[model samples]
Target: MPTLAINNFNIFCATLGGFITLFGLVSYLFKEKYYLSEALISLIAGLIFSPHATNWIRPQEYALNDIEILDTITLYFTRLVLGVQLVLAGVQLPSKYLKKEWKSLSFLIGPGMTTMWIVTSLLVFALVPHISFLHALAVGACVTPTDPVLSNSIVKGKFADKNIPKELQKIIIAESGTNDGLGYPFLFLPLYLIQHIGHQGQGSDNSTRVAMGLWFGEMWAYTILLSIVYGAAVGWVAKKLLHWAEERKYVDRESFLVFAITLALFIVGTVGMIGSDDVLACFIAGNTFTWDDWFRLETMDDSFQPTIDMLLNVSVFIWFGAVAPWWLFAHSPVIPIWRLIVLGILVLLLRRLPIIFALHKKIHQIEEARQAVFVGFFGPIGVSAIFYLYVSHEFLNGITVDGEIREDAAYLKEVMEVVIWFLVICSVIVHGLCIPMAKLGFFIPRTLTTALDSLGRTGSDSSDDPQPAFQQAQAGESETTDAEDRLRRRPGWSRTGGDSLPTRVFRIGRSLMRSGTSSADANRAPGQAPLPVSSVPTIIDSGDGDGEGDASAKVDGKSDGSEVSTGGGGAAPSAPALGEDVISGRTIRFHDEQQQQRTEEAKVGQKV
Candidate 1:
């Protein structure tokens, strides 16, 4: 008796139709900070509708052949989408941008990512009973690789700037983008161990150590080394081939460029099927194709890649909903839903957040702690996690154990399915709500509470407070006016403050004058005294030893911190002898009464 069978065609149509409908709704009614977006709506609809349509959780048993075929098809779709993402992420970003954010990049890929994996795994082991450490860690590792497909909604300036630091979007985008490709080894290694660890000796007397050596030499090497070499070679060949075709005028339509991307992805995936790492190869090709000597390689348009990416992404989610034992998890006597929610909270609050904060020494681009916290919250374990979970279940599907995750593939499958589905579902809702909350400024009061009451601090607001202009610019938008560039160009801050700009001057910190160009009324924080509409001549830092602000900002009666007035005549303020910046907040400028009087006296003396 087959448990569930929707046939491949129906699965495809449902995902495609649902995706179209969801996007249509989002486009029509959900543009504002007020409404729910396509991603959330699609997920909810799929959870509610896909399963019943497919007979997913009924007593009928699926044929082994049908199940395996469906699994293989979905697996390919995952690879295709992942391949496109790798190419899009790698080719689009300049090497210089990576260099600029290397410190953040280091932490994101290394400690920050790893620690989250470890912490979340430990929490799962503790909370989710009947799961072995290896399986738990595998789940943890899967979740650690974030998809963040819809993350742009909040990070690209949708959140009210008060709760979210939009600048952190660069880190989030780059981190999520790179890690999804890089996480293959971590995800697969444990599953390999769990499936083959104790059984290796049946073929030959293979001990754990021997098995590990073979696994490392084979899987790891293919993943790290061969994959890179093959991908780069493929990239080179494709580039030349496209150039030749273009020269011969065979390639005329821009839509044909989709083939260029899809072809490369297909080649990479084929190599993986032959035992190389699909992800690493695609990622390498993505980067390699974008290099200088590519002769204007055929590239997919940014808009097209996402649309293509969404089709597969939604298919996986909808398919998961259709096949997964949603009824069992909700009604099953094995694990209560309340306990599952508690575990989710524990991992999210304890495991997810603290690691980000602890890694702050490296991720300096986050100017405010609240920003780092917001990024932490929106770190949704999305499509890639689902892909890895499917792979894990395939490997661990039939195995059973007496100690923890018992025999009975159905039970084990249900457990893994429940945990993953629950986490992702919760993430979708929590992450979805946060965007609107940010837009509505719900976090502003929370920000005050965290800043003053929790931290036990008080401050007056100055122009140094958070600036909307400092937030990251949208694609194709001009970045020349952004504070990101301003901070990065400064030398010392590159290693420390993370695209550092002296942002706010609270009451206790320093009195900051309004940017000469900004409207005073709009910049003020709630519960803070209004800044005078009379604009102070803002010292725009032309930056790096160009003493320009010195000449322009010095009002005759006002004191530039490093200047003084003589009684008889105004003497020029001596330029700071060192090119080294004082490593202070953008220093506030004000005139003392004594300096004002001396300037007046000097003026009188000059008149005489």
Candidate 2:
């Protein structure tokens, strides 16, 4: 017999690696891909073929005898995965969009989410009379946060047809990043309600109200706002410490982010232990970190967040499938099948329409009503929801109101659970299916779309033409710049900020070098500052329609390298420059007069 070698962790690693590898194969095998979404693939695979190496029972009863391990899995993995993602999402969002479209974003994530939660709560109460109202509301709030993983899978798939509006997609991504954190208050409301309900029957009004105030008011309200404040504090604090450490030669320039990432994790753990919500804190932290847009870039955009999210998300999804009681459909003799179907449909349907209609009246940045409707409906519950679902399970399992255990506690827990599982299945399927039909038309009325368009200012998608705005500038052009601006792109200095693989890494490194770089390593010369690659050289447009003008060159040079450095410019990952390592996309170009003077006047359109 072939020797079998695997443990729980190893099985998990194998599943994650194997699924990811298979996804790559599927994607490459069929260039014209349709059904190879990573999230979808993982979910299906988990359902069919997980190792079940842990406490999970073979038949998929979905029982929680080993709640501790499951909770650990959900808590630790979700925090690490979702925490970093939330932060990256916030940091990487273009500041211009935040400023220009704050109103629209607010409408999308704020009132839109609240309205959906409220509607779902109402529907749950109306349809499933047996489930407690507060419990239903908790699930409502739980489901309110949209899953970007699912939405992105669809938008990125062949089904999107490149017609999925960019602005709309951005709004969805931004809103999903936030709504999970924001929606937690409602989720907690139910648990608190469950605690209070039995106590209220005991008729200790003063005590109950005080307990409610402590949990709901102080813990819930004050904690969320404080987490936001704490988040802002972390960003500025990290930067200050980073500067201090670098200036003191305590850390290497290349390892600067080690300090920042450590600070983030510390802040998260400390905040959570202190009784404030850490998820909200971390999300806000990401948004607040590197308030400057230039510093907000992810070092390796292709490999960083995408890779982390995929591994963590895919593992969780598959594990969820492995543990998911798809058998619930069969064992759910407690709730009628028709009711479950109706509840699931109502949960999904109630998500979009109301929010879009309400938001259209005030959000000027929204290009169309149908577009808003499309986004509102696209609110699929994902990692965060999964985290909360397990949390809800933990919160609801066992324990009766007062000392006397409610006989129906088991039934109530399962009933509430049935709704959640149904929602997950419905969301994955419906949202996934709807991707193909996205281009057909919006569900909103044409008259409503026209009215919203007339009432609100019209918006256009960003230009699709490949040439970047900087390249549009005339060469040798020197213009007055704001004293506070740090942009390196001026005449004579062409900024190819997209140098090498990690723009964030290089950008930050370049900034530190300019600020007096000091390496901690003893082998290297102590205070060597690495000079930045000047902007990419382009034909100087002489402000003429014929592209024949040169603006005055304002050279802002910062170099400890009086010894001229050659081959300085950085390369974009997809767009390699001439004379560069193709695999790494690294390049060498002149940034200063010392090096530039020797540079030949290379012909235009020549590679490198």
Global lDDT of each candidate: 0.57, 0.57
Query: Which tens-of-lDDT digit does each residue in 1-608 have in candidate 1?
Result: 86776775565566558666766555534534354544566666566555466433221232244766666665666667677766655555544445577778888788878887888888777877677787677778777876746554554322333345445665776677667766766766665565556332332233566547656887668666787788778876776776678789897666445754675567655886787766667766765665553422334323465566556555555555555556756675656888788977776676568877777656787766776676676677776777777776666654545534334334446566778767777776777676666556866875665455423212423344333323322223222222444554566542232133443312112223322233343335558875432233222222122111233332322323244344436554433312223325634332222233334434432332
Model 1 scores a TM of: 0.62
Best by TM-score: 2
The backbone clash count of each candidate, in order, is 13, 18
lDDT measured at residue 17 in model 1 versus the true structure, 0 to 100 = 86
Poorly placed runs, candidate 2 (over 4 Å): 1-10, 28-32, 51-65, 96-101, 154-161, 164-166, 199-208, 242-264, 298-302, 397-411, 437-608
Q: Estimate each model's TM-score.
A: 0.62, 0.65
